[model samples]
Target: MPFSFPTGAARFVAATACALALTSLVGCSNGEGGGGDSTTESATSPSKSGGTQVTINDFKFQPASLTVSPGAKVTVVNNDTTTHTLTASKGGSFDTGDIDPGKSATFTAPSKPGDFPYTCTIHPLMKGTLTVE
Candidate 1:
């Protein structure tokens, strides 16, 4: 004898499972995780050492532009499926070689106030700006 779900229960269960799986995938796909809009800003509190965080999600940096105090430590977190790099556009200053998915890297902000632009060496089109105050 074989057992099975009642009526359309099996179909409903399968559909629900697929929906859930897609939901999870969507979050990693663009880093918004249902948060909506890739351009939205995501702020992080400064740590004891005056460190702050920037999230790399869905191929775009959350809070694409960040302003922090001089000498503050900025942590870059990769929440996407692929590896990413946060390299200074002009070289030197700070660079996170390669950050794997779900991984993170840290760098110190310039001690002087200025605008520092960065991009993913792997994905040149992915860009961000850091403002040191």
Candidate 2:
């Protein structure tokens, strides 16, 4: 092969670019921690008319159950050390992506007038539910 070598400066630039790309990819996880393999369905804003806040900390969900009016807004606050996602189960009315520690995720759902179970996609043991009337 012809004489070809990366100078120290060139190598540094290439390494920096690679590091940046990897960091970006690592931050794109759906709702899971590490890599870009997010397993949560992602949260969506509901067309409802109410508001509630759920805090995630101490490896548990605060106020595991909530009762709100039809068409309400729910805000999920993540205060844990790891990433956590707020996802609705069957007939789910909301889904929130990875909420980093000390961060929050908000989701608005249309008035459904019923009960909806939710949980953290990253930690299945952390679960909760919402009841709308």
Candidate 3:
């Protein structure tokens, strides 16, 4: 015979424990555990309409490095609690103005193909790289 909980409360507790264990396992497999590479890369492929997107969450870019076609539209999503801006660190190649919290902004990739480093204008410490191919 299989083991079983005697009461409804006990069953609920058992189910919750199982759910928590599964959640941990899922988080571990994905990069959500913060144990693997700290950066993400979307190289040269983006949806036709949505385009390439860099998610800003927890004060960092989800995909720290991205590669897109020249003049392609790059969307900057601000999922963080505070506002942020994806601005080019060096030359004024690309800037997404200011993206409020829960908001998003878009910028056009430079025509010239090369590596373009960027950072959050409000939070300079947050940095990322954009490659135009």
Model number with the top lDDT: 3
- Candidate 2: stretches off by over 4 Å: 1-50
**What are the per-model C-alpha RMSD values against the true structure?**
6.8, 10.4, 8.3
Question: Evaluated with TM-score, which candidate comes out highest?
Answer: 3
* Candidate 3 per-residue lDDT over residues 57-125, each given as its tens digit: 777786888888889898888886667889999999999998998998888999999999998887776
lDDT of 1 by residue, 1-133 (tens): 9986655877889888888787566442334354555564535546445578888877888767888888888888899767999888985778999999999999888898898888888877677788887
- Clashes per model (N, Cα, C within 3 A): 1, 11, 0
Q: Which structure is stronger by TM-score: 1 or 3?
A: 3
Per-residue lDDT over 1-133 for candidate 2, one digit per residue giving the tens place of the 0 to 100 score? 7977677999899888888677555442223344575333223323233357777766666667777677767888887667888888775568898899899888875476887888787778676677777
C-alpha TM-scores of all predictions: 0.65, 0.60, 0.66
In model 3, state the lDDT of residue 6: 60
Native-to-model Cα distance after best TM-score fit, residue 99 in candidate 2, in Å = 0.5
